[model samples]
Target: MKTVILRSQALQGATASDLSAAVQYLIGVDGGGTGTRVRLSDRDGVLLGQGESGPSALGQGAEQAWRHIQQAVQAAAAQAGLGELDLSRCAIGLGLSGTGVEAQVEAFSALQPGYALVALDNDGFTTLLGAHGGEPGAVVAAGTGTIGEGLRRNGERAYISGWGWVCGDEGSGAWLGLKAMRHAQQALDGRAEAGALARAVWAVAGQDRATILAWCAAAGQHGYASLAPLVFDHAPNDPVAAGFVADAVSELERLAHALDPQAELPLALCGSIALRLSSEFSGTIRARCVSPRGDSAEGALHLVRSALQR
Candidate 1:
């Protein structure tokens, strides 16, 4: 069964003649705030090539997102010994960030260039599909930001806490990094206890408040997410850092609960920070968690295959 589904969608019109005339290829894109990745595969699901490019998140603008994806697709084709691939011969799948917004999803459809077929969905849900091999399962994507996404055995889907930093994304790498930065500030001002985490953050941003504030002001989602390892390194021994980790864990646990109250579905912790923090959830949540079978790119590929099968 295909993982990607749209409430209302129109597949790129293609006659059987067109699909049969060319040696068709499949392209899968996993586009998020940090970067974009593309996978190229044959109709039989054999991976031929892959490539990567700049950030392609929906919030980054529809034009830019497609540009990066096209670049990656081109690169992948080249790597596969097929250069400058004809779009008409390909089916593309995209699991992109920020598609949770209705407008972003519509904008995507509006701006799409012609292809033989296309499928798209929120990155979080795609990750869930990838992790579980399209089976019913859940995923907590805790990268620069966080979102809890799941698909049920019966075709239902659910999402939680994908709002950006100013609003939601409670247990994300950005959230943890922001918290660690705050602790660094407090320690410098003699307001809070500082440890390895605080020292590391303070040292990196300069030892003074003015420099630190300037760094904070300039930090974007990707920039803030980079600071998470410091907190992770010190969370066990530093009270301030520990507090941040504790809160983040609680929020993520809540994400699981919101998606599956009975915790019956298998869960996969995805993205950089969440996977690293898996050991932290030793009890209820961890008990039901498993490693993802694949990543978002595979999920996108699955969708592309599904579209072709139709």
Candidate 2:
């Protein structure tokens, strides 16, 4: 029965023929604030080639991000021995941030000319799709920022947290780093309990208190969030750092509860900081959550394949 269904699907695809002549390459691209990654795969989802580049979608403007995406795609295609291939022959699936803006989305959509089928969505959606193998689940990302999103079994979607750095992102690396720095500054000013946080920040920045303040004036939110690892490094021995982790875990737990009142579904943690703090953070959630099965690129490939299958 399964074989028959598979054969029928194959026949349907062949009959449709929209992508038959194009070599049916599944291309998945993930563009985030930090970087961009592209993956090329065969019809069966076997990854053929992959390439990465710096800060594609969020950091740069739409035109620049699109250019980066094109370059990464070209690099991957070339690596897969598909150099000089027609863009229209490829099925492109892009998961990107900052494209949700009307102007950006329109700009990106216009760049999809050569592809037979193109699907573009926020990178978070693709991350969730990849983490859960296209199944319904939730993901809490905690890199420069934090956000939580989930898809229920019935295809209903929910998002909890992800208010960005200033307003939200409770358990994110950015949050942790920000908190740590604040505490350190407070301590330096004799307003807070003394701990290793101040020393750690000074050490990481290789500067004294006055110099650190000057740096903060010019550094952006992400720059401060980059220091989160130092907090984790000191968590085992430093009470202030440990307190920050605990606070992060608490915030994430609140986010999980917001997504599901019952709060017992599987949640996947993505991004560098969330993964690093999983042991400490996961303990706060009663639900059965796990790490992502694959990266966003794989999820993007899955998206492309699903489009082709349809």
Candidate 3:
């Protein structure tokens, strides 16, 4: 019996023609801390189906993540008119949040799914691939959590922020919400000036200190992000919200600037809040921003095809 060395041997050495003949389907997954989506296509890249499910981000339980992915795959197959989908005939590509962490990456690599082959990478890379259509450019992902990613013509890659909800991910939904909560707390204590945004946060998070504190203990990134919309809605008339937006824009600028220090490369603003925040960019980033060519799922598929062809 031979012991399989997956760490060194996975996703290596398969000819294009060989894989093309052996593989009947391709599945691309875009997974984040909040949700997971799956897109299915045939060997030739014609779209077949798509599906979405719960969160599959890293650090979450591996079984939970795989389970949601499996469910999403099944949903896609059903939408593709297949009553019975065989995983062994399908190849998969996944771009997942938190996979940048070495331990998280290693944990996922150890898994043996029934797919013919699998390619896994951090979600930001796929975001960059999708935004730029595989070209050399950068993307500032402003969503539940923010991150900046880029690829140079020479294949040099860079990532900034995305340190998660607590300390980093500046200008992200969670960041805004966290700031809003802080303002709300301060308002209650009379320690800082409160405005319409802070008042709104108080209404949503409960009016009392004890109640707000309890909610904070139970709240996660999503909960924090849910408050961002309120802040955005009130930003026009609310000084506090306006301040939050200003800070967020500056942080995003920092992220984009780090990738293209000279602010020369084409940049795309992506994720849930990209368009909303785009108008706030103060520097060259505003002009450098380009529309995304596709999305993360498409990039995942593209990566799969690229790998197979290699």
Candidate 4:
């Protein structure tokens, strides 16, 4: 995977002495099915650099997540002019997808790369932290997968959905792609009309029954999610695409309702797919929508900061 490094101006004018004397560096990671994004900072929470790498979702495998995380962290360190980063001097925070699975969480946590400090939480919870700045609110994040997280005013926490792409994660990119695949299959089998959406799926997966079958057999969650854009691109003119999007919207609303039944909490719609469908929500839900104060990577930084205080 290609690694991209970026510089940050958060502490542009600060001198070396301005950095924390204890921790040399702070790293915040947002790892999901599509990619891993990292933020490098000084202990004062001043951004130093940023980096990105391929998928690091725990569902993909702990080893895979670790490899991508290391790559991204190295890239970030390089951008910050910290050559050959010393993990032992850094405090790290991770907001990773697939934390819903206990086995996956344990496996991923076991592979920590010897940081001076480490804090980990599911991407959803971290998103909630970032969205409301750890205040009382909720967030529904949808990209390669979907999850709902909320921190109530009563200091209570709520989690909903996010069952992964295999059987759940409704309204996710993978879910939409799966629905589109089913439409294509029905069209090919003469159970439904071959529409623009079906033709588009054929172009990517296969043009015939046998090829399509072979493609499905080899496809994983990420592979299926790769087709979500096609579904969106054709939504304006394809009934099937529009139908899938409608279902996705409904699913998102359900998640919102489940998270805050009274619809009283400030809600943030996050990730590519969720943001794309934000305006489609009903009046009540839309009214509750608020822009996130920060992204998940920033929230991960909060994680490490909290860990340090403890």
Candidate 5:
């Protein structure tokens, strides 16, 4: 793969007359573990319509995910009043979670003929691009998992965390949820004092300790991670919940430190959980970041536009 480097300002201004002229339709898709989102825009970047579907990416299986993407694009196009839009003349931008892997890439490549021009990359890459307005910068992503990436002024790159939920992702929603569950179990078993964390878990899983245990036994890391919002909701008056937040912030800070301690540039806090905790976590992460200019959908569009220009 060839690396495409552009000045931050230049990247933001990228366009393609050829692609634009052929584009009676344009679609940007952001496919992740949680779900998929589609955005339709005109040649000039005017928003036309949007749609959503369940997770879509090769890692989730090519046929199934592609079906979802097809449905989403069709819905968006229909809403945009371009019901019979030709895929052959459409410019497509896909930010897909699993496509970075070789097998996944091959699967995506096999499906490329479905559209005029298609660009596929890991969803995180596009998220960073959109968060920074196509600028060279960094992002800390804390959702079901945690990861950080940076693009230096010289076009070099650095990364931290993102080892996955079990061994890494220390500050992620899955981590926090796991901690909360452990605390709850410990409290029930008389190994620890019953605290706010226990109460929060019980409230979400039900009041019975046995029910909570059963839920934990059946659920995977992602299921546990789903409880993070409950933890945050209880944090204001709950010391244990507050501690979880503190620890999450500390882990995020570690990720930031691993990138460049002294380097001062825009850092974006992305992903569902990170976006929610930005105010609290920003202080812990040291260098403050700017609000995301857009989400991964916009970033996918930005990348597609840049690629066409090149």
Candidate 6:
């Protein structure tokens, strides 16, 4: 069996041994629009295994999220050499996307699988918890979606962005992809120059107006997000792609500013898009960014541990 090692500082000094003896396992789940990732550990915080599965974003559906989470948990159990996990003997913590919606949260919580204990929060908050090891700081996570959260010294918390892809989540992969599609549409109409970005988007979205319309009809958040890599790949040579990257960087910077207007809290950039665009950030913001101590999954573990202590 493969052994997993997590960042030591984040996992140190937090022994879940004091939890109920019946709680033999600690499972941390980080679920987003892109996928669900699970980190399995013994109660004592020893890493056991890690597993990943398809999207578990609550916006996708509460039932679908649970199914994906269960699949990931089972995979983690198998990787740990455990035949099957006993939910009743485990405590689970989840950091998931779309937890901002009260109805979705309620729906997902209603389906809890009999775990001994549970703690849940949006992925942005969990990312903040992990980035700072539960300290006062801020994080802007830009992946399939985008969110900014900050913890102040007075125990106050602030959230910025994270409005989801339909109307918000600027600087996200899906947002980038949406912008790329717009560029392609304009190019196809001859309203804009047909550059490399337009050509690439057309290749995936279809070359003709009818086919493009058909593609857009079915291109949900995830489908549109699938085109984000093209933007990144062409940014080096394509002005349109480069402009999108510039806009994304600015959007993320705005999130940081909104999260901590005073800019006092340490800031950590999380998620694939955030990391990829980090270097492109303005010098001031770049200087303020710090590497995260852990990730959302680890923060979920911390969440349940705190819950158990209370």
**Residue 262 lDDT in model 5?**
66
Query: Model 5, residue 302: what's the lDDT?
Result: 88
Per residue, candidate 4 scores C-alpha lDDT tens digits across 1-310 of: 0111111233224343332344578899999998999999997788999999999999989999999999999999889898878776777888988877778877876776677667788888878888899889999999999999988999888989989898999999999989999999999999999999999999999988899999998888888999999899999999889989999999999999999998889999999999999989999998999999999998888877776655
The most accurate candidate by lDDT is 6
Measured over all alpha carbons after superposition, the RMSD of each candidate to the real structure, in angstroms, is: 3.3, 6.2, 3.8, 6.7, 5.6, 6.4
lDDT of 6: 0.87
TM-scores of all candidate predictions against the true structure: 0.88, 0.81, 0.91, 0.91, 0.81, 0.92
Better of 3 and 6 by lDDT: 6
Between candidates 2 and 4, name the one with more favorable TM-score: 4
What are the runs in model 3 whose C-alpha is more than 4 Å off? 1-17
Which clashing pairs does model 6 show?
Answer: none
Error of model 3, residue 15, in angstroms: 5.8
Per residue, candidate 1 scores C-alpha lDDT tens digits across 171-249 of: 9988888888888888899897667888999878878978998999888777777888888788788777778888888
Q: Pairing residues by index, what is the TM-score of model 4?
A: 0.91
lDDT (Cα, tens digit) per residue for candidate 6, span 45-99: 9999999999999999999999999999999999999979978778888888888
Tell how far residue 254 is off in model 1, in angstroms.
1.4
lDDT of 4 at 32: 93
lDDT per residue as tens, model 5, 171-281:
888888898888888887889778776877877776667798789777665677888887898788888888888888878877877776765768888988887777775
Q: Using alpha carbons, what is the TM-score of model 5? A: 0.81
* lDDT: the better of candidates 4 and 6: 6
By TM-score, the best candidate is 6
